[model samples]
Target: MKMRSLIATALVAALPGVACAQEVTLSFAHWLPPTHPLQPTGFEPWIESIKEASGGRIAIDIYPAQQLGAAADHYDMARDGIADIAWINPGYQPGRFPLHAIGELPLMMSDAKSGSRAFDAWYRTYAPEEMSDVYYCMTHSHDPGTFHSKEPVRTPADIAGKNVRPAHATMARWVSLMGGASVQVPAPEAREAIAKGAADMITFPWGSIFIFGIDKEVKHHLDTPLYVSSQAIVMNKDMVEGLPDDLRKVIDDHCTPEWTEKVVSGWVDAEAAGRQRMIDEGHTLYKPTAEDLAAWRESAAPLTEEWMASVNKRGIDAQAAYDAYVASLREAGALMGEN
Candidate 1:
């Protein structure tokens, strides 16, 4: 996957008036119910940006919640040209997107804003070529995921023998490190799985529980972020390459740093709202101290070695990429410090 650098300045300026055979229509598919936090929080704003940028030259129709197929299918949908655009989770298709897996490593990100920044930095420095197949709009990770359980989970011993829904493979690894069995349950299934006794714990973004109505069955939440889950937005390769300059500019404009920050801000807002809603309903939030977190991280170190190996087998330089990602974050932090 190889992508040309940003288009020339002159061509970019004249893109809007570039004539087309007829009006173009783009269908973007996602796996959230209409009111899901991510959809309203970020997706809608992105679409509006696209529409406004297109200046009526192109039209977009948003299909939410597998109105077409699951999140796993989104990558393929865009690859096989099923839809013009799709919100995809590389974690959903394990063994295939090992580079993106770095974003899922246990406790890697402190917040969505940091994780999202890390994601962009990871792509720009390590995996941009790998993602060139699609016209990537942006990539972002969850702020942080806490433990939602029927019983309090404060330490490794507490998670022993529990069946937990690990949203991403990295979280699945966290479950293993904590001595818990892993259960495959998407957000929508969290409620049912908890209710049926199929799962005893879950790692998820707080705001999503309300969006998916899972808090009703979840009684307690851990304070520590076990990890963050991440996904990328991509347009069909051909569709993007063929876009007239104006429309391409619109795409670029909608996915900038400013927009990414807004997206993260929205998620944080939703998480705050969800936390309040759960507290209103008597859900208890507990924090495990640094000592407890150290214990958990010790058990989780083996996972990073195994994961790096998994990515290496694919000819991807996992450790180097991870190192570069950390370096980029430090660089970003320093720049922020200067500001």
Candidate 2:
């Protein structure tokens, strides 16, 4: 019978190579809080090392707290694919990522694995025109950032008229250049905007104000590493161009810079063990005084001269990318506080 129609046309040409060898989850979205430690110690052990280097054919379905949307819409939900991977922050959209605010300047690099390997090697030298669309997969920072107040701010005249909350937009223009009043929420609504007082001080990081419970509604903690929050993890560029080149080289061998210093030094050692469990749950932590941290670093020196005139009006080379990100954090000794 024509050899049974040539073995049913070779099983219909091997059914699209057995449906392209099946298995491929992805999804990922983020906005923290899956009992955050950037989710059980940084994206569940980097999604189990990209499902054991893709032999399991890649799988990952995260979608933490924001469950796939708001936290400033996770970099446009991974540039509109609505999440094939996200976790972005890029200072939660301020001026749409102004050169990732040089790892949110101020007192840069103290931890978060050498400021996430010097802001993922200086934002991969401007990620194809500052992160072209998507697929950028690394860049991290967050271990510094202070004043989780309810009072006791130390200096900069105790952050003048309060109502703070900053976290992005250069700490909301360094809390409107040290005179507070910048309230823009979103760190999971900053513990209900500082427990319904509608914010009186937030600017977190370093145990993320008790991983977003805002340390049971603030009581003051300025341990002073003030400023660091320039995250990224993007993916969806047509889902990494519809992967498969060996699961896109196991997502480019776990999108590295040595896995951005092993997933930001395990979320900066879980923000130094959540700031020593908010100083053993007592929480009035303070610690400033080097002349009140030099008057809060001279009131944050005009936020690094207005972030080098907004990265030299976008032409960039903002002081050679801030002196090669402080000489790659003093060649990775991880030069903490007092720049």
Candidate 3:
């Protein structure tokens, strides 16, 4: 069946001046809810753009809320052709792609737009090597997140002995480093973890707390841009390679750094609104003092050391790569708090 589809695509490419509308359709899978901002704001628009660019030769159908596969399996789904394109969270599979993990570091990104631009550009340089299994499209950022706990977490000491549902692998290590138990779970299951007493707090972006229904489970919120998770859209290599030339070009056009910003823009606004909603609802949103931030910064420094060591073992100049990443974020004015 796959061979016949490839042969038909090849025939279309070989024909002399023959054109067809809506001749190619790709399956795009993601784990976010259908109502998530990324749907209407990001993927839908981008899909339309691709169809328009190809003169209606390309169409992309999105399968949301893990309808195609689990969130952690999206990367492999794209690589193995389970989905032609899949949205993935690199940090979900820890230590697998060390270079990409740098994006998960604490206090790295500020706003989603500039961060998306910076991260997409920077990761392209390494993606050919680090994420070689699939066609690396583009990367986007969530607005940075902080601690939303059942109790106040003003200082690093406050995290002691608590169970936390971390945003990603980096945050899990951060929780462990602060003497908390990292209650490992995906975003969808977060509220259940807290309600069932498996976790007492969570590190998540502002608006997602409500979206995931975790807002009812925890009260005290640390109003800080602690960290942002890195996510990407990738395409199956075979599917892309087998597409007609015009359709392939359309796909390439949508995979740029500029597109990353467009995809993340709606999500950015939603997160900002989520933050304000928490305040309006009378949640105890604590903006950390300069002293408290200093302590948090001091505590997080070791995670970098550990990250550098892990990258170095892979034969890359870890410090240079880390510096380059920071430089990219700085150039984009997206280094957390700049905006």
Candidate 3 lDDT, tens digit per residue, 1-339?
144445676788678897633266788999999998889998999999998888876777889999988889999999999999999999999999888888888977887788889989988988998989899999988888899999988999999999999988999998888999999888877889999999999998999999888889888999888899989999999888877677788889999999999999999889878888998998998888999999999889998999999999989999898898888998999887665
Q: TM-score for each prediction? A: 0.87, 0.34, 0.94
- Clash statistics: count for each candidate: 2, 1, 0
As a whole number from 0 to 100, the lDDT of residue 20 in candidate 3 is: 34
lDDT of 2 by residue, 2-80 (tens): 2343465456658875544545676888877788776777788988988887777677878788876788888777878
- 1 or 3, which is superior by TM-score? 3
**Could you tell me the lDDT of residue 189 within candidate 1?**
66
The digit string of per-residue lDDT tens for model 1 on 213-272 reads: 777778898876667788778888898777777777777777665566666667766775
Predicted structure 1: lDDT: 0.74
TM-score of 2: 0.34
lDDT of 2: 0.77
Shift of residue 102 alpha carbon in model 2, Å: 5.1
C-alpha RMSD of candidate 2: 16.0
Clashing pairs in 2: 145-227
